[model samples]
Target: MSKVENSSAESGQVKVPESVVMTVKNFRSASDIDNFYRYINDNRLRREAKMILDTVVKAITPPKRRRRSKRVVH
Candidate 1:
């Protein structure tokens, strides 16, 4: 397995793996290519949106504190 560098943030471009590219190229119908691209884009968007929402929620939410019990000394 090759290490994939995430340069999407820096370049604003998605780096499709060579294998996926070749597979897509081998697809017979144009609709197949379109559907594949759409699926990829939708998944990427959903993941990114979820990450952003999680970050925002974490930032806005307060941290939980544990409650301490009081003990009586005789």
Candidate 2:
């Protein structure tokens, strides 16, 4: 894995493993998806993270789930 050495702290470039890049390219498991979310959540780069979360993460996560109500009366 080629280590991405952060050239500058102010650059807002975080080092990511090659495996992580591969996983993001094609998710293999829930953990892979989780890694994407975690990266967005954990990063101090709010603007970048927000953009990805709003576009990609927002699309993939389930919107909602509803259950039918059941009632019995005498």
Candidate 1 residue-wise lDDT, 1-74, digit = tens: 23344556466777877756655446755676678668768777767756877999999999999899999999
List TM-scores for all candidates, in order.
0.34, 0.30
The local distance difference test score of each candidate is 0.72, 0.69
Off by over 4 Å in 2: 1-45
Clashes of each: 0, 0
In model 1, the runs with Cα more than 4 Å from the true position are 1-44, 70-74
Superposed by TM-score, candidate 2 places the C-alpha of residue 31 at a distance from the truth, in angstroms, of: 18
The most accurate candidate by TM-score is: 1
List model 2 lDDT by residue over 1-74, tens digit each.
23345453456778677765664446646675678777767886668867866899779989888887888787
Look at candidate 2 and tell me the lDDT of residue 8: 39
